[model samples]
Target: MSFDIGNPSYGLVFWTLIAFLLLLVLLRKFAWKPIIQALNERETSIENALASAEKAKEEMARLSNENEQLLKQARVERDTILKEAKELKDQIVTDAKVQAQTEGAKLIEQAKKEIDDQKKRAMAEVKNQVSSLAIDIARTVLQKEFEDNKKQEALVADLLKDVKLN
Candidate 1:
């Protein structure tokens, strides 16, 4: 028998159909089941990785917010400390000024008292010198008057006449 190019025999067609069906059954059992199972496992792993990435992103956002709040709190604390330091500095300056003024006033008063004391001492000394000079002048005049015998007799007679019995 001669083989035809376009038309096949009935026996050959029947055998080809049986062989195709057998190949499909063998591929399903050996390759198709494992391939489908592997694809399902790959899909599940991809989903788990996406979930983990989302969780990490949320955690980073929360951390950023916490850090900002902490920075703001630190700034507030720093400002408070600076304000207290400024107030303390001003108070110290004011106290120093007051103390200096008080000391200056005390020194002025002390100086005035010292001057008054010196002036009083000087006046006392002048009065003593004047009294001593007056006594010396009176003694010199008496000595001159007593040197003349006739004046001395006349002075004695005047002094005796002025002495009267009370």
Candidate 2:
């Protein structure tokens, strides 16, 4: 028998249909199942990565807020310490000034008392010198008066008359 290029055979058509169905079954069992499983795994990994990123972002925000609070607390503490130090310094200066003033007053009082004592002593010395000088002058004057016996007798008679009048 001669074969014609344009003529179709029923046997070839039947075998082609059977071979196509067999290929479908084999692909479904091996290649298609593995491909679908790989796609699902990739999807799950992408979702997990997104969730982890969100958690990391929230943690970063929390840490930032905590740092800000710590900074504010430190500033407050520093201000309080500085204020206390300033108060202490002012108190010390005030105390020193008061003590200096008290000491100055005491020294002034002591100096005044010493000056008064010296003045009293000087006045007493002056009085004593004046009295001694007066006594010496009076004795010299009396010796000159007694040198004249007639005058001395007259003075004695006057003294005796004054004594009788009292």
Per-candidate Cα lDDT values, in order, are 0.94, 0.93
TM-scores for every candidate against the unseen true structure:
0.69, 0.66
lDDT of 1 at 63: 91
- State in Å the error of residue 138, model 2: 3.9
Question: Judged by lDDT, which candidate is best?
Answer: 1
Q: lDDT (0-100) at residue 31 of candidate 1? A: 85
- Give every collision pair in model 2: none
Off by over 4 Å in 1: 1-20, 141-166
Worst 10 residues of 2 by lDDT: 1-10
| Candidate 1 local distance difference test against the native | 0.94
- Candidate 2 CA-lDDT value: 0.93
Which model scores highest in TM-score? Answer: 1
